[model samples]
Target: MGIELLDRTALVLFSGGQDSTTTLAWALDRYDHVETVGFDYGQRHAVELEVRSVVADGIRRSFPDWGDRLGEDHMVDLQVLGRISETSLTKGMAIAMADDGLPNTFVPGRNLIFLTFAAAVAYRRGIRHIVTGVCETDYSGYPDCRDDTIKAMQLALNLGMDTRFVLHTPLMWIDKAETWALAKLLGGDELVDVVRTQTHTCYEGDREHIHDWGHGCGACPACELRATGYRGYLARQQA
Candidate 1:
């Protein structure tokens, strides 16, 4: 059976990246009311933070139906995460594989902390659903992105907060290619264009160079995945 649309409100963890933007579209399509939250954790690719407003505006202007459903946005200051994390995303270091076979770009406990804060905000706002874009497929080996971890977090949030907040990971099982397709499916070419032109996913925070997929350094792992996924998406379309 097809999933039933929830008439409740949702708060999406939107970072203005392709995946997050896509997930925002997904939430806007499903929920009656939708809000957004972003974190300023002093990452190297802070450009993603700047583009959040632009992408949100694009969605508001292009897709009026979703625009009507879209609601307020929130920003959280988690610079402490940056201070505490020694990974490449939080620090000025090379993106390399660590000894434990994970990318240095993996900021430890990022999704966990994000969910905790999001749940707090949701608890106050009386929102029942919290949406995020963390995916294991086509991801950079982040343990927190795993399905099991998200399920555990969901259980822990309900127990700790005493609220039955349904954590939504719409992109958890999908890869980058399918993600592009999902954008197209959710909002058509206009939404796809918003994702391709407005979102920022480069780890190096280089928005000066624009590619067909979007703005990025095109060499970072994030860019590589996005670009490869776009290519695969196109190939499937042509196939």
Candidate 2:
């Protein structure tokens, strides 16, 4: 990355989840001005939307250095996406595998649509760099979260919008464990605590039970991945 890129403002596709929170911290560390964009797509885990402000406020309070770089936040109403998406994420159906072998929790074209909207916002805000946390290693077979999908979206966004917009996925190759480690690396224990207590990742949107890793239903795929990753992160820390 060039110094010019670092100096330019960045718009982060922040969903108030662990991955996006960490990515937000990553952007704050690199960019001089960092803005955030979240989508209210009517996901079953809508609670994540509620925590977005809390997480941002937590970061601002705990990391004053990075807080100075934090800029505006944009919340795009994408309820239409929920109306069209029949997946478990948008619906109240039980999480299961579809006949095509992919999990029902996979929201088709979610990241693609999200990137498109983020690009539009970035264009209006004069931001050239767009950061996201979509990863393939721990993506749970979500096609939209794949590295290839993100690259293609970046190309399409730039071509369709007639502007140069670079989509940055810092967690593209890292697993959940590495993601946890990245948060610690970016903002130390403070960032980790914010992510653990403030961010939401459970597919079922369960916040009642607080686990060692965080709050979740503890049985959902998301909660399982988060818990398992935290254990691995802890083990590595001990070593």
Top model number, lDDT: 1
For model 2 the local lDDT of residue 135 reads 88
Error of 2 at 11 (Å): 0.4
Clash count, one per candidate:
0, 0
Model 1, residue pairs in steric clash: none
lDDT of 1 by residue, 55-162 (tens): 999999999999999999999999999999999998889999999999999899999999999988888788889999999888888999999999999999888877
Task: List the candidate 2 regions with Cα displacement exceeding 4 Å.
Answer: 1-7
- Each prediction's RMSD over C-alphas, in Å, is 3.6, 2.6
Prediction 1 global C-alpha lDDT = 0.92
Question: Could you give me the TM-score of model 1 versus the true structure?
Answer: 0.96
lDDT of each: 0.92, 0.91
Off by over 4 Å in 1: 1-7
